[model samples]
Target: KWTWSAVFTLQWLGLSIAWLDGAEVLYTYYYPTHIVLVGVTVSLIWRYYGR
Candidate 1:
């Protein structure tokens, strides 16, 4: 439920940005900054929960 709420919040933020600027939805690089953020989040979860 919490992850669903987080996804909803991210969607709302993305939509707000896209509404303000059509270019906000565009991904300009093969290696985007958000990918790094995702990697860090995954690594943290793995560090805490991995066997």
Candidate 2:
């Protein structure tokens, strides 16, 4: 179940980043912020469970 949840979380995060990037036609920082957040989330999850 945790693996499924992790995959779902990753997909949702990717979709979120895509949405933010798509929405930020002017304030381009939004894309980078979303990417950073997604990176941090993935890294944290990996750090905790990647062993």
Candidate 3:
């Protein structure tokens, strides 16, 4: 869980830095990756804590 949290945090941080650095071209690619990560994170949390 912490591993995923760290990954999610780092992913956002990298995305923010890239956007601030004028890397808009990467946004298209990052969007889908971000969505998938979010989905996985949510499912993992539900599966772990929904007991």
Number of the top lDDT candidate: 3
- Give candidate 1's whole-model lDDT: 0.58
What order do you get sorting by lDDT, best first?
A: 3, 2, 1
lDDT of each: 0.58, 0.67, 0.77
Regarding TM-score, does 2 or 3 come out ahead?
Answer: 3
Write model 2 residue lDDT over 1-51, tens digit each, in one string: 786577568667766776766855424655565567668778977898998
Q: Report the alpha-carbon TM-score of model 3 versus the true structure.
A: 0.64
- Judged by lDDT relative to the true structure, which candidate is superior, 2 or 3? 3
lDDT value, residue 48 of candidate 1 = 72
Candidate 3 lDDT by residue in tens digits, 1-51: 687779779788869876876757457667778788788888988998899
* Leading candidate by TM-score: 3
Model 2, TM vs. native: 0.46
